[model samples]
Target: MMDAALQALKQYFGYDRFRTGQDQIISRILNGQDTVGIMPTGGGKSLCYQIPALLFPGVTLVISPLISLMKDQVDALKDVGIQATFINSSLTFSETNERLSAAAQGIYKLVYIAPERLEVSGFVRILEHMHVSLVAIDEAHCISQWGHDFRPSYRAIPAMIDRFARRPAVVALTATATPRVTTDIRKLFGIEAEGVVATGFARDNLNFQVVRGQSADVFLLDYLRKNRDQPGIVYAATRKEVDRLYARLTQQGLAVGRYHAGLSEKERAASQEQFLYDDLTVLVATNAFGMGINKSNVRFVIHYNMPRNIEAYYQEAGRAGRDGEKSDCILLFAPQDIRLQKFFIDQSDMDETLKQAEYHKLEQMIGYCHTETCLQAYILRYFGERNPSGCGHCGNCLDTREKTDVTVNAQKVLSCVKRLRERYGKIMVAKVLAGASEQKLRSLHLDRLPTYGIMKEQTQKQIGEFIDFLTAEQYLVQQGGAYPVLALAERSLPVLKGEARVLKKGHIRAERLAVDDALFEVLKQVRKTLAQKEFVPPYIIFSDQSLREMSARLPATDHDFLMIKGVGQQKLEKYGHAFMQAIAGYQAEQKNAVN
Candidate 1:
């Protein structure tokens, strides 16, 4: 059975190996176990059910939330010569019935449906008649109210499964699920702990970065100008920001598009198509843009503001480098971003408890932005996965450092808090230390204290940075209340007594790589020509990774081309000759030039 599954993987998807947790999940499902797969974004979770669908005796019913994802997956599957179809609100009533009738007759091997369809009486009646062999739920975290994106529609899944004449093995999959959300999913599906397979969240190919104290507009313009031709997504927090960024980028004459809920359905679809088809090099969007998008070549995902929580940020940022190539995930953060997120929490319809949970998650996200530790390690730890620190590729680890011993500065700050009775927030503390002439300071007599103005050499921004760092490192803790106050922790005793040292790194920027423009251009031409001939997305034929590999390897024959990662038996048979011919021609041209 395992061998058959492997055969299906190679034959259909063109992959020679299973990613970390895919094989076990596939094996467990084939062995007749109902499972929950908690893999990271880009971890190949779809293959868990996809491969089994090929082996199952009847059809696989896939419940997905997004219409775009359904169309994208169905197209990709059909491109690989797999029989698949989708039934969604986009179809006319007659069209839906036609597809449902075909599915009942086993004309399609896999059927994709929106979760809302499961609640429809007519759709449920049709599903009961279909010979369903498997029920695979994508974005399974939507079922958990504790999750960042919860949908009440997902609650209808288990009941829908019960209506099936022959109960199929259930596999629930999600890219983002906290421990609490994971338990909820398991309990909802009645799956035991051993039946759950969570392959940990870590994307080594992504370079995570957080830059503060810079104008986001200026920084974004500079960065985009440098990598003008590469594919990227700039995520803003609101539709207004999306529109603003879109207008600015468009004014600069870049191939960019904008997506938000505000756009009409036709406009949103057109914008998405433009990006997916490589007509747009950049997409400026709110969180609404990326849920089920499978565009594989996005080289960067920049957050114009911090998201409300780590789960949302990680999922959004993980969209980059889905093809397992080097990509950038940058967050341009400002303190006001937190205020904006807090405003969202205040306006949300969630209950008080859920709102409190969101606030706690927000604080963790703020600590991540300010922490001096390795960025990757911080994210992995947040997801309950422990790994060794100092992943050498993150912004902090790759930064050229001049570590200043801030032990004395930390002691001064902690002592000032004590002298002031720990009644103030960070700004107040900085004001007292920077010796500001504010009336509040004078009225409170804080200006008369000996500790005041001791660190006047430091700028207000510098003081705030140090304070945020101290709070993150636990030398200073923030008390919880309507107006939280900064209080010294037990660890501060060591720093105050000169027993512990604190270090701060002055980070120098790293150099960017110069792309192989000539070869990259040639490959794009070939991909465009091929995509035009086939009328499919270019990445579907050969991902950006495949093209990059081809350019680097200069494969001159069919055999050599097959060795590339995404090239499989099916793809090799269909498109190998053309790519190999292009590579051979390019190599010959280079040789002639050298001669």
Candidate 2:
């Protein structure tokens, strides 16, 4: 056992030590125990199984839902001189038969198969008879119905897991899962022994920020214009959105590719191959992109639309900054996001109970958006981890919000909703409050309500903003049923009936995140000094993330310089001198420290 394990680690993987959670999970599997790993993206999840495949006597079966993911993994393993192969519908009949034959003969260290393909003929029989050392399930959360990305084929895993009595220890991997989703995975795998390592949902290396109240096209255009040549993903909520943006971006001369559910399998496969090969600078895709992707140089992930749940959001956003460099996760939000998501949910065949649960999850996400609590901390807490107050890396922590006395404003909105009898939607209520004398509104007799036109003090836009704020504060609840109606939340009564006074509301502006003047000036100074000193392009000396890091936490010493993202040994040796000098100068002048 010791010799095989040593040979496997040293000869196959070419590594000296195991990543933080890899060894422990592998040991559990080697000891014949089931293991479930709830690791973050770029957390060295594949190593856990790759190493075990070499150590154990039999073939390691990796059940993946994504053909592209399996192909990427197999190619990566092959690149590093390890024996790995995959069987899926993408391959021809002869190719599948050949791989299965090799698997039956115990010739390959690891064999990957799609979950859908496993339910077909000649699969269960081979899995049942082959010397299956272990079974690893990647993206295991897809099996649960509660997840936004669900598949009926994932339900086939347990039947396959049940086929082997002395089942190779089951090991599951997923980048994102809520407390409920995690519990569901534990139940499905029926693993008595599990390795549940939840790295903090917070990514200190990545700056998480958002720009709300803009059309996706405009927001995406601005982002691309700024980060012109960077590696990133532009995530859309639908296929049509993806195609629309893809065409526009291509026309704008950006080296872009598109991926979505509507694309033919061949088109998606080609697009994915090009992306993995780095032929495409950016992939404008629906949420369907980036599952089990192994690329490490992705510098940014821009969500063109709001994600359905924080789990999906964190998982998708976590794709960035994998190499421990500075990365950015930017969300472009519009209040219309909820309506879009709600419309999609309404089309699903889920029961009322399930649909309601999903809707509330979205509501909780909206509450998160309007929160003053740091975005990273809120995300961590929602995933069952306790994070300290503010992360200082998110939009809320980095920007200042003006506190306003909104007591009178709150009262006016509540009175308007009640006076309107909670019968109309936001548009009608907004029109009445803004004193808009429109034809449809007049026909409904809302033009003569007692509170109608009483709120002429606030404009149409201001009233809509205030209504969103009130909804977020829980003073107003969006009535949920066939068509969404508006009414006051339970907490509104106390504020209206004089039980509590009003509180301050905070707002975030886009231009600040789009450009940080303090940081921009510092970057200019650094670039001027560095360019003169080293005679290289300023951008080459320090990338955008490095500059942002310099601004956020000014690193003076050489040790601290290494801590600044993207500075490898080569960069630190070549360009480290200039940054340290400026940092020293900046530190000398500050009566207050950078922290």
Candidate 3:
């Protein structure tokens, strides 16, 4: 069975071997055991069920959550010569029935359906008649309320499975799952702890970064200009910001699109389609976008504001470098973004318990922005990894700016927060420290405080930023929601007593990732042309990683082309001649030019 799975993998998906957890997950599923797979965003989770689906005698049912995800996965499957289809709201009733009939006839080896479809008795009746061999649940974290993105509809899954006369093996998969959520999923699935297969949450190809105290627009424009040809996403916290950034980038004549809940469904679909098709080089969107997006060539994911938590941030950032190529994950943070996030938490419908949980997560995210330690290590520790080492490529690890000792400055700020009786926000604290003669300060008699004017040499903005830095480093705590007041933490006591020191690095600039070579560009154009001809995304035909390999190897024969990664027998048979001809033509051009 494992050998057959391996053959199916190379024959269709073009991979020579399984990724980290894929083999183990597939082995368990084939052996008829309920399994749970926890992998990073780009860790090839889809292949875990896909390989098994091909090897199984009966059809595989894939319970997906999103329409776009269902369509994308089905389309990719069909392109690779697999018989697959999706039943979702996008299809007409008759079209859905037609597909269901076909599924009943055992035509499709895999059928992707929305979780809601399982609720309809008619739909379940039809599925019951089919010889369902396995059930694969994607984004399984949605079933757990502890997960960041919880859906009550996922709760119906187990009951529906029990309705099956012959309970098929089950496998639940998710990209982001904390230990708490993992336990919830295991309990819901009735799978033992040993049944879980976690490949760890780490993307070596992604470079994590947090850019603070910089003009976000200026930094984004500069980064875009530097990597103008690369594909990327700019995520904002709200639809309004997405619109504003989209307009700005569009006005600059960049190939960009926008997606948010505020847009009509048609508008959102069009934008997503354009982005997936590579017609647009950049997408400006809110957190509502990029779930289950399988685009492999995204080179960067920049957050215009701080996300609500690290889980959301990591999943959004993981959208980049899915093709196992180098990519950047940048967060442009400001003090106001924290307030905005807090406001969101305050306005949410969550109960007090959940709200407090959200606040704690937000503080951890803030700590990530402020931490002087390795950025990737900070995230790993947050997700329950034990003593993770620093990733040398992340922003913090690559930072070469000289560190400046600011213990005295920190002590002054902590002392001011203490003097203010912890009743004021950071702005007021900064004003007092800068000796601003504002009427509010005078009316409150804050200017007369001993700590006032102690840091008067620095501007108010500098003082406020320092306070933000202190807050992020845990020296000071921001209490209350929407209108948080600065309070000293236990960590601040040592600083106030002059027992510990605070050091901050100078500003670091974003650098452009590597550029494509001439041959790679020529092949990319070929891919684009082919994609247009087929009316599919360019990456579906061949990923940039595959194109790079083609350029580097300059394969002259079918055998050599097959040796390149992502080139399976099916893709080789379908696309081999055109790509090989392009490579051959380029090589001939070089020879002729030399002659």
Model 1 residue 219 CA deviation (Å) reads 2.2
Q: Against the true structure, what is every candidate's RMSD?
A: 4.7, 8.5, 3.2
Off by over 4 Å in 1: 403-517
Span of ten consecutive residues with least summed lDDT in model 2:
508-517
Q: Using lDDT, rank the candidates from best to worst.
A: 3, 1, 2
Q: Give the alpha carbon lDDT tens digit for every residue of 301-344 in model 3.
A: 99999999999999999999999999999999876788798898
TM-score for all models, in order of appearance: 0.84, 0.72, 0.90
Cα lDDT of candidate 2 equals 0.74
What TM-score would candidate 3 get against the native? 0.90
Ranking by TM-score: 3, 1, 2
Which candidate ranks first by TM-score, i.e. highest?
A: 3
lDDT of 1 by residue, 143-183 (tens): 99999999999999999999887899999999888889999
lDDT, candidate 2, 267-319, per-residue tens: 98778766655567699998878984766657789888888778888889988
Where does candidate 2 clash, by residue pair?
A: none
Tell me how many residue pairs clash in candidate 2: 0
Better of 1 and 3 by TM-score: 3
